[model samples]
Target: MPVSSATSTAESPPAAVPSATVPHSWEYDGTEPFPEKEPAAPRDRGERLYVAVTAAIVLAPFLALGLAGWLLWGRLIHPADIVLALVLYTVTGLGVTVGFHRGLTHGGYRAVRPVRIALAVAGSMSFQGDVIGWVATHRRHHAFTDRPGDPHSPYRYGTHLRGQLRGLLHAHVGWLFRNSRTSAARYAPDLLADRDIRAVSRAFPALCLLTLALPFGLGWAIGGTLVHALTALLWAGLVRIALLHHVTWSVNSLCHVIGDRPFRTRRHDRATNLWPLALLSFGESWHNLHHADPTSARHGVDRGQLDPSAAVIGLLERLGWVSDVRWPTPDRVAARRV
Candidate 1:
C-alpha cells in the first residue's frame, strides 16, 4: 500500500530541526540558558544628599573660621601665622604654577629628578588632589575651555548676571564636589607613566595632613602655647587654602567673565588680564596671555606685571634646577594682540 503524503510528512521525526534555529533544551529545563541581569537604575536621592552633606563638611568649617576671624576684636591671626601662611602659600602656589601648570600640563620646562619629585610633593601638600588628577582636570579645562564639558567654566550657566554669579560659584567650589571625575588615562598619561609621580599621588592624603599639622607644630614651637598653635592652623592652613582656592577659581570665573581681553584667543574664549590678582594668584591673573601662549613659562609678559611665580621660575632656571624654559618671544606676544 502507498503511504499517504500527510502521514509520511508527520512521521518524519519533526524533519530533524535545524541546530541553528532550534531552541536549547536547557532553556525549558530548571536552568536558564542565559543569566538574568539586573538593570541599572538612576542614582538615588540619598546619594545626592550624601554629596551635599560631604561638601558642607569641607566648606562649612572654613566659612566659620573666616567669620570668626572677622568677628574677633583682637588678633585672630598673629604675625607668625601670617608668615607661615604666606610661606606655605608661596610654596604650594609655585608648585601648582610652575610644576603642575607649566611643567606637567604644557611641558614648558624640564626638571631634574629631585626637582620634579619635590614639586610634586609640594603640590600634593596643597590638598588639591593628586598631581595627576590636577593636571588632568586643568588640561581638560584648557581643551574644552567654556564648552559643555569644561570642568569649571563661568560661562556654562549663561551670560546673564545671575547665571554668571551661579556659574562663578560652581567654578569656584561646586565643581570639586562633582562625582564625574576626569579620566587620568586620557589626560595625564605622562604623569601616570612616571613611578615617582604615581607614588606621590598615592601619598596625597598624608601630605595634606602634614601640610595642616606643620603650621600648628611650628607655631607651638615658636609661641610655646596651644592657643597660638590653633591660630596658626586656622590661618596658615585653613584660611590660606581657602584663599588660594578662590584665587585659582577666579581665574576660571572672573577671568572669563570680566577683565581686559588684550590678547586674542579662540572665539568665545574670553580669557582676560586681571592685573590686580597678578601677585595674589602668583601671576595666573594674566589669563589672556596664558590662553594665548600656554607653553610659555611666563604668563605675565608685559613689563611691571609683578609675576612672583615667574620670578621663582627664573630663579630656579638660574640655579640650574629648571632647564629649557619656554619664555615668550616678542613676536609671539605681538601676534596674539587683539
Candidate 2:
C-alpha cells in the first residue's frame, strides 16, 4: 500500500482502512534520483501557434465578456444564461478534477467503459490539453513539486514579494506558454499505451468545438432565437471555460502561496487547502490532503469539507459505473495529521 515519499496517509493503520484498502499511492519525493527528463529539444515561446492559442483562451474571454456587459447592458447576462454556464461548468470542471486528475492520472478508482469515455470526453472539453498531456503535466508536477524541475512551482523565483508576484503569474498561466512541454513519454507512458485514451486525446480539438457548439445549440433549441444561441456561446462556452481554467490553475498558484496546510506532507511541497474554492473547484481545493494522500479518491475527508467530485464518484460506484474507490477513512486522516 506504500509507494514513496509523498504519501504520508496511504500507509494508514489497519483501524483506519480495512486492510489498508486504498489501491494506489501517488507520492513523489525527488529521492528517486532525478534524471534529465525534459525534452532535449524543447519548444519555446517562439512557437507562435502555442502562444496564440494560449493567449486566446486565457485573455479573449475577459475582453469579450467585459465589452459585452458594457454594450448590451441588461440584455447580456440573463438568468437562463447563468444557469447554462453553471451546468456546463460543473460537467467540464468535474471532467478536469474527477476525470483527468483522479481517475486518469492517479487511478483512484476503476471506471466502467462508458464512464471512462464520458470522463475523457468531458475532460477534453475543458480546454486543459488532451487527457494524456494533462496527466503527464500533473504527474510531472507531483514528481518534482516545488523543486527545480516542477513545471509550475511558485517558488521558482526568490522568496521576496516581488519575486513571489513573478512566481505567482508564472504558476498561474505563464508556464503554459513556455517553450518547454512536459515529457509525456516519460510521465504518461501508461496512457500512451491505451488506444481508447489515445483516440480521445486525438479528438481533443474536435471536442473543443463540440463543447462550445453544444451550448449554443442547446440555447437556440431552448429559446428558439439566434440571440439566445449567441448568449449561450458567450456565457456557457467562453466565460465558463475561462472561469474553470483560472480556478484549476489557482490550485497551482494560490494554493501553494496561501491557504491552510491541515495535513502533513514533504516540507517543500507547500500545497494547501483553500476552503473558498471547495465548491467551485469540485473539492479539488483540498489540495494539502491531496498531496498527503494522492490516490485516496476523496480529498475532503473532514465532515464539513465539501467535495462534489468525490460524491459523484460515490454515486457512480453505487450505480456500478466505477469500482475500487479509495474513499478516505478516519484512520488515514489521523495518521497524516500535522
Expressed as tens digits, the lDDT of each residue in 1-338 for candidate 1 is 01122112212221222345344452212111222124546668976875776576468546957665683556566789889989999998888887777777777778888998898899888777789888878877776566555678776667677777777887777777765578787777677878998999999878988988999999898889998898888888887887777787788778887788888876556788998899988899999988877777899988788787778889889999988788899999999988
The global Cα lDDT (0 to 1) of model 1 is 0.75
Best lDDT goes to which candidate? Answer: 2
Residue-wise lDDT of candidate 2 within 74-110, one digit each (tens)?
Answer: 6666667789999989999998898988888877888
Each prediction's whole-model lDDT (CA): 0.75, 0.80
Off by over 4 Å in 1: 1-61, 67-72
In candidate 1, the residue pairs with backbone N, CA or C atoms under 3 Å apart (3 or more residues apart, or in different chains) clash, namely: none
Per-model root-mean-square deviation over C-alphas: 18.3, 8.1
